[model samples]
Target: MAYLDPRPANPAEALTELLAGNERFVNGTRVHPHQDAEHRAAVATAQRPFAVVFGCSDSRLAAEIIFDRGLGDLFVVRTAGHIVGVEVTASLEYGVTVLGAPLVVVLGHDSCGAIQATHAAMTGTRLPGRELGAIAERVTPSIWQANARQITDYDEVGMIHVRRTVENLTRPGTELGDAVAAGRCDVVGMFYRLADGRVSVLAAESAGE
Candidate 1:
């Protein structure tokens, strides 16, 4: 593994690498790659992470541990609900355009408190603070979509949120979208299972698309 290549040739390769790592984690066979003293020194001068992980701030959703990835493997950004704001977009753009990351992964998980809170807010429970309400507000669309589809499952709402975030990031006018258009990157949305520690793809778009 070229642990220091920020650009991994193509999106498929980068996505595959992440999924493989998740598989390792699922099977309890993680090799803990790129975390040793030597690899640490190798990335000390310059870092070249291959994927940018935009995920929720849920404690159990720790990107590196959940994906079985090590240092210099993933550039990660997190928010309460993985809500995409201006700063999120800018950070992801820097990862793709400046760091040359080939893949962006939006990871949502089952039993997400954010999703539950958003659902509660939709069903008449008020959120406490303006800031937290804002986070819940951002996640409300997914809950609404789920309700429109007659799906009341919290995990499914989380998946919808993941898909929406990926869509928003890769939409026509965004920098991430431009990178995808230019064959420089791709975006994938996935759901993490809290009970089993596995990941499943919910939405994806490649440069080929």
Candidate 2:
């Protein structure tokens, strides 16, 4: 079967689709679109997803489930704390620059263990391993940014990290940055409430700055 995805015209409609899906999820009326065998096979040949969701790797934060998207709707990338490292940067560039996705979402949530550990380490508790320490190191700047505003809570810090992440990807000279500069893409930072199943925008960088 030829799966026909009339791509969103721009970032605004792309975001609307995501928010509407989350509303469906929150209201327990998920349609669960595009999971059939034909859709899977169609996407296997070529995927033109509308958005790239770079989120925390928490089990409860499944992008498709929470956003009510199915195969080929989203190009999803994830990391603990949703860190934007070299690999992640490349993946996002692939999604927007190559696949032509118009929107990039940085999704973070409350009660995140990664943000919690970063907070603990900031408070002088040592991270258990070299890799874990590196993760904390990447998260340090966000906590410091939060501290400048007197915010010490993990969820608040996570929001700060997500916002910082959006800024990084949309700032000048990066791949996503170029895309945004040329009015081809937008980057948005979003926060998810684990208990309420709601996602809200924290910060955004639309096309042309």
Candidate 3:
């Protein structure tokens, strides 16, 4: 079967499509023609992705593969810890405003190194360089909150970060916020388990207009 644009009118439907696709991926029965040359050429003319995914830059967690989506099917923005930086925000803006994507998923994963490093920093463990420090700094607030709750596991910490990041995207003046408020987009958070290949959605509320 060809890769279909499953951009549903209801935000909940969009979420369902993503979850269903992930189920297909976990079962090893992904749909076809997503990466083919013919499909690539067809998408070269114009693209109409159904959803925008903001995920971590972890090699083990590929948004397309995890969602069982093909090229041009997802407008993906990836960064360390799935941080919502200016550039990442801009990319999501383009995806939502320009590409007309109806769903935005902030995808974090289990055992994320970024979350671990942030936890270490928050716990007074020295980080090596400024580069790593930057990542730690971005994630420190979530780490501190998780630490306050006595959550030590990397998976728990990562989930905290995912929820915080999704909250950040929903804040006013953000592209995600605007799109969501206008009832044109939905912002959701999810966690991908590397071991079991399951994606757990953290939030289900629609970005109400």
Candidate 4:
């Protein structure tokens, strides 16, 4: 894969590549592509990752391992609840604009501690650590949204949060949004199943619209 010419020329192709890799992982037929020492050295000077994955920081959500991709295949961003703060937004912007990635994946998983903590906080529990509490605070809106819809299950709440994150990233006027609007990128919301090691698409924008 040449750094100058990226593979999976379109968003659909990029998304397909990730899905195929995840299938390999799920079937335990992982090829672990691009991780050889030679490929690692080849990408050291430059990287042209095809997708930018913004997913929860859960241990089981390790992007490369689960996606079965090796070096320079994905530019990954992580937060406790996969929160999209300024830094996360900027990093993804760079991945798309600077790195020229075609696809952005927003992944959330089941049994997320951040979701649980946010739910607890909503139920009147006092969180101890200031920074940790702040993380929960960011996730509070999703909890509220779920509650408004009478959805109390943590995994369901996680799906709502992931969908919200996808909406926020692709909303009008943002850098990511502009890219999508111009037919330069595609944003997909995905939910990961820890039990089965599978991924399901929750939301997606086709061809930027």
lDDT values of the candidates? 0.86, 0.89, 0.83, 0.89
Q: Write the per-residue lDDT of candidate 1 for residues 53-128, one digit (tens) a residue.
A: 9999999999999889888888999998899899999999998899888999999998999888877777777654
Model 1: how far is 63 from its true place, Å? Answer: 1.0
Q: Which residue segments of model 4 deviate by more than 4 Å?
A: 1-6, 126-128, 204-209
In the range 1-209, model 4's lDDT, one tens digit per residue, is 34533478889999899999999999999998888878877788888899999999898899999999988999999999999789999999999999999999999999999999877777777553777887887898888888888999999999989988998888899999999999999999999999999999885434432
Question: For residues 1-209, could you state the per-residue lDDT of candidate 2 as single tens digits?
Answer: 46566778799999999999999999999999889887888888888999999999999999999999999999999999898789999999999989999999999999988888877887777554777987888888988888887898888778878988888888789888889989899999899999989999885434442
- TM-score of candidate 4 on Cα atoms, chains taken together: 0.93
lDDT of 3: 0.83
Off by over 4 Å in 1: 1-7, 204-209
Q: Compared with the true structure, what per-residue lDDT tens digits does model 3 show for residues 1-209?
A: 34344446666877888898899988988885368877787678678888889999999888888888787888988998887678888899898889888898999999898887776676677563778877888898887877788887888888888988988888998777877899998988899999989999895434441
lDDT of 2 at 196: 88
Q: Using lDDT as the measure, name the better of candidate 3 and candidate 4.
A: 4
CA shift of 100, model 3, Å: 0.3
Clash-forming residue pairs, model 4: none
RMSD of each: 3.4, 2.8, 3.6, 3.1
* Cα TM-score of candidate 2: 0.94
